[model samples]
Every structure is written in C-alpha cells, then in structure tokens.
Target: MDKSGNMIDKMLTQNGLVYKIPNKVAAKQGPAFLQKQRSGSVAYTQGVAAEQQACHWLEQDGWTVLLRRARTHRGEIDIVASKAAVLCFVEVKKRRSIEEALVSLQPAQQRRLFRAAECLLQKHPYWQYEEMRFDLFVFDNAGKMERLEDILRQM
Candidate 1:
C-alpha cells in the first residue's frame, strides 16, 4: 500500500478473484500528472477551435475545405482547401500576438508539413490540382487574423 492507502500490487482473493491494482508511480505523481493532462486537453480544444475558424475564413473566400485535421504518418495538416484549380495546405497558429504566432511555426515544422502534404497526396490521389501551395494563417488573441500565402516560396 502507498501513502494514499491504495494497494500498489494485485491482491488475490480466496474465491479465486484477483483485484487489479493502480500503478504506484502514477498514483504518486497524482495532481501533477492530472494538471498536465488538463493543460494538454485545453490546448487541443483551442487548436480545434482555431482550425474551425480558419475553415470558416477559407469558405468565405470561395475556398472549399477538403479536410480538417488531416493526419498522415509525418504529421497533421490543419486545413486542406481548394479554390478553382488551386489547392492549399494551410497551417493555423493562434497566439497572444501575430508575431508570436508567426514565429511558432519553425523550419522543422515546415518540413514536416511539406512531408505530410506529400503523404496526403499519395493517400488521396483524387485531390489533384493544377497548382498547390503552402499557407500560414495566424490569429492573435486580439481577434486579428492574417494569411501568409505561399509560405514556403519565401523559404
């Protein structure tokens, strides 16, 4: 038994029933682990909300959203949208300031996004387009939004 009065190991009963035990390490971590999990959940929810807003903005601009939160072996693509013959892989970032959000997407992450886009194209051959580009959509906590088109072209 640990300090919390919980059994740290499995207990066997005379009636041939075995009681499952909690992990001692996890039990010991307790509140700290739970706090981390809660923060992670909050971040995930915020990310989803940002992606939804990005999709809405795209639709307003005559773009059709093909996929939201598209997952590949490389990484996740926030939004895949098409307008006419152009296809865009958009990366959404939300931060306290536009500069902060823009800087959050580093070069390594850009490489991952490129690889993820390739993986997605391979998986969905029907997403063909005459032109494809990478874009960055940033939102600051002040409700300001900005779109940087052909983000990789400048790289």
Candidate 2:
C-alpha cells in the first residue's frame, strides 16, 4: 500500500486514475445502517435537515435545548429541550404539509420515545428534577414549523 501511495511510482506508469481514499469511521453519527455508512440517501438527509430546523425553531421560541439526537439502545430522542423548568422530550416529524407531519408520529414510535426518555433520565439524574413532557415538532417540506404540545398517549 505504501509503494502504491508513492507519487513517483504513479507518475511513472498511469494505466488508471490515481485516487487514494482514506479509511476512517464516520464522526458524530448514529449507528451505521446495516453496518454501512449509507450517507447519500435523500430521505436520511432530509430527515436530518428537518431535525436541525426543529432545533432552530425551538430556540427561537425560548426553549433551552439540552441535547440533539440523544440515543439509547432502544431508540433516539430528536431533541431534549426545556422552558420554564419544564423539560420536553421532543420527537420531530417532517412531511409534505403541516397536517401530514402532525399525523406522522405513530403510536409505536411514541412508545419508543417514552421508553428512551425514561432510560436517559435514569442514566442522567440531574434532569429528573424538571417536569418532563412529550412534544412533537412537525415540519412541512417547505421548512415551516408547528408544535403539538404535550402529546397524550393513545389508550
């Protein structure tokens, strides 16, 4: 590999293009899908961008964000934020319209978020003092934001 990396050898004989790619793990990422970094998918990129937009929207509304993409073995929290001593475990949904986004947080995902939040609080005791609630930050395709505050668990 070192001999191949030597520019002198490449300059002497060029049957193919010279490209040396680095082998490094992805930084600041959730676990790789199927153990591979499938980074170019449009849906994944849009979802990430939606989460970032949700963060900005929360900040503008006087919410103090504590964490972005907090993960547990079971699931991930999109944003952990607080305002007026009330901590919110936020789940963000992005869709073609605000109404569509509102309906996107399915019951199964809600359960996962709640379970993840419980696990996270157990590990980090300091947040336990604050009153915790579930919220949904819904965004449309055009980047408009809406809030569904204190989502109730479906019975």
Candidate 3:
C-alpha cells in the first residue's frame, strides 16, 4: 500500500475508528462515473435494451446462456452462451443498419473482448473443453435482429 494508505490503516487501528480522506481526482470524476452507472438513468439504456432483446432471442434459439455482461480487466463481454460443447461470446450493438452496427465493433474492441473471454475461461476450467466462438447481435433501425455467427472466423 501507499504511505497514505498505510498511515490510514495505522491511525484506524490505534483509534478503533476510521476516517476516509477522499481522493481529489476521484472526487472530481465521481459524478460523471456515477451518472453513467445509474441503471435507469444511464445514456446506455438503449444499448442495454438491445442486449436484453438479444439475450431473449438467444434463449429462444436454444442457446444456454451462461453469462450476461461478464467483465474482466481488459473489457466486457455482452453475453456468453453454450450449446453442444460450443461456447459463444456475443457482442450486441444497435445502429441504423447492419453494416453500421458491425462497423461499430472496432478491431481494438474485438481484441479486448477476446482478452476478456480468455480471462473468463481461465477462471472456469470446466469451459476449457468447449469450442469458443465470437458472435454479433445487431439490432437494425427498423427494429429487426441480425445474428452473425462465428465473427472471429475472419479475424
């Protein structure tokens, strides 16, 4: 721990009470992060709705969803599904068109998603035997759904 953190621990142990010293940078950035974190008030509500729609559709399509919104230090995976020994990691995006939605998932983002998937698999060894696949769920402007299976096949 840092010197300040050690000092805080020492003072708390001595006094049998703890007082927090707020981080100035964190305090300055907190409101924006808090606003984004609000479940009902976040600007990402549309994206969340789209992901929910995709999850429902996946269930209907006979996929066993294992995780939703799984995260790692690298990035977040929207959904994880499995069927017949195949594990799918999904990316859900809503845009005006299928092309636009697919384009939105940039190459850099794809790498991060892959890294996140690796992290999840490492944490759960039971999943190691399954064949991993990357899939995309694109919600079009007309409220239509398009599923692109095995997206990373081209990668």
Candidate 4:
C-alpha cells in the first residue's frame, strides 16, 4: 500500500475512526508534553503528601478530621476538622519555605474558601458547633508545619 493508504489504515479501528498521530508528529511534540505531565504529577504527589501529614498532625492534637479535599461549587477546601465545640475550615499550603506557603494564599483564594465553607455548612446542617473558624496550615519543604488559627479573624 502507498503511504497515504497505510496512514488511513492506522487511523481506522473496530469501534470507529480514531485520529492517530503519525510518529513524526509525536516525536516533534512528545518531549514538551512529557515534561509538563511529569511536573504536574510531581506537584500532585507533593500536595497529597502534605495533606496527609497535616491530617496526622491534627489527629495527634485531638482534632477529628471531618473531611479532606472537600469540594464545593465555590471552590475546594483542603481540610475540615473539629475540636471540642469548634469547627475549622483549613487551607493547606506546601512550598519551598514557610514564608512562601504563607504568602501563597491570596485574598481571592480566601474569599473562595469562605464561600466554600458556607456552602458546606448549608449542605450539612448536622455539623453542630458553637463556633466556626478559618485556619491556615503551612508546610515547608523541610517538613516543618505551622498552623495559624482563626486566619480570617487575624486578617
């Protein structure tokens, strides 16, 4: 078969026509795509590890973690924990340094977290608590963790 005929055959499958990139095209773009994929995977892994460590710390401190990686229509909450009669919505940040992690949470993100917490409270009326607060948990690359209580009130 000619080159065009062979290409057409490669694109066809039992289910339907599938667009298969020719080797030449893939070879030209594969390196950049692979690099991005690797970086994204690394970031995701690090974030998960940080969250796990944060949860462990909370548990050790006699806090019950109600949720981790909670999703709402407004935004995502990293952690939701309770101690005594207080409920906390926590935002976790891991960076090269504690300073970097502290600065990572911007005003816009704070607003989003507040909205997400409100959504969560409305969705689950059974979560009884005398007080609710927003907390910031920052972690450095060296495994140091710092918890800032009532972060919104501090601001």
Q: Using TM-score as the measure, which candidate wins? A: 1
Residue-level lDDT of model 3, residues 1-155, one tens digit each, is: 33344322232234676766545554455556656668435437778989999999989989888999998888899999988878999999988788889789888888898899889988777774447889999987788888999888535
> All predictions: root-mean-square deviation over Cα?
4.0, 9.6, 7.5, 5.2
**Which prediction has more favorable lDDT, 2 or 4?**
4
Q: Write the per-residue lDDT of candidate 2 for residues 17-74, one digit (tens) a residue.
A: 6664432322223245424556446667888998898888889989888999999998
Give the Cα lDDT of each candidate.
0.88, 0.78, 0.81, 0.86
Every model's TM-score: 0.82, 0.69, 0.70, 0.81
Candidates, ranked, lDDT: 1, 4, 3, 2
lDDT of 2: 0.78
How do the candidates rank by TM-score, highest first?
1, 4, 3, 2
Better of 1 and 3 by lDDT: 1
Candidate 1 lDDT, 1-155, residue by residue in tens:
46777757756566788776667766677777879989889877777788889999999999999998899989999999999999999999988899999999998898899899989999989886999999999988887889999988534
Deviation (Å) of 134 in candidate 3: 0.2
**Candidate 1 accuracy as lDDT:** 0.88
Give one digit per residue, the lDDT tens place, for model 4 in 8-104: 2245455776775455544454558768889889878999999998899999999999999999999999999999999999888988999999999
